[model samples]
Target: MKLAMKYVILYVNDFEQSMRFYRDILGLPVKMEAGTYVEFDTGATTLSINTRESVNELLGLGLTADVPAASSFEVGFVVEDVAAVIEELRGQQVPIVREPVTKPWGQTVAYITDPDGHFIEICTAVG
Candidate 1:
């Protein structure tokens, strides 16, 4: 049997700030929310955010969102215009990890980190 993915959740330090980032900044609609957990509608899979403190208390794993290193994975978004989205994000004082650049494969991409230090890639569809 093959395993199927359901939802992706990022345990964040500040729940309100992260909700603002995805809800207001990135323009993702909220699909569901309960307590400190939230799920965003991405038109495909659901992207979720929750408090690290809650997860730790529930699982006893002692997870922390304070790591200084980059995570091994990134959440990517395909947009119509890379530069326009980047400009909008910059206006909200979000720090850009990389300016929009066209890759050799013909996709214009830029990078930014979420409130939880998760890498978010905004790019144009590959042509």
Candidate 2:
């Protein structure tokens, strides 16, 4: 079987705040917005945001009373300066899960959880 990842949907509590983070702060290019859904162009893949209930229903996970605090997957993005990114996020008063730190994989990584508590990693690979 051949499978390709066309989209990554994130569950967000506040749509506008999440959209602002993904669009303005993260700098992902917005493709379209319809009601509660917003799509972004993420180079080879697409990023989307929708309500938790809708996502759960689509995944066949039954109806969930509330969205989980965190996602099972860690979404990563390469960055030039993980530290700078952390600083910028801090300046904006964004919640920081883990401060900029070097990982065992030789990457300067910074981790943060989105409004819905999905983990996001910003890292710079060390050669």
> Could you estimate the TM-score for every candidate?
0.92, 0.82
* Model 1 quality (TM-score): 0.92
> How far in Å is the alpha carbon of 10 misplaced in model 2?
1.1
lDDT of 2 by residue, 1-127 (tens): 9999888877776788889888887888989998778999987888899865666666765544364646678888888989988898888777898898887878898888776778998889667
Candidate 1 per-residue lDDT, tens place, 1-127, comes to 9987778988888999999999999999999999899999997789998888998988887877776533778999999999999999999999899999999999999999997678999999987
User: Which sections of candidate 2 miss by over 4 Å?
Assistant: 53-65, 69-71
Give the Å shift of residue 55 in candidate 2.
Answer: 4.5
> Worst lDDT window (10 residues) for model 2?
61-70
Q: Report the C-alpha displacement of residue 42, candidate 2, in angstroms.
A: 1.8
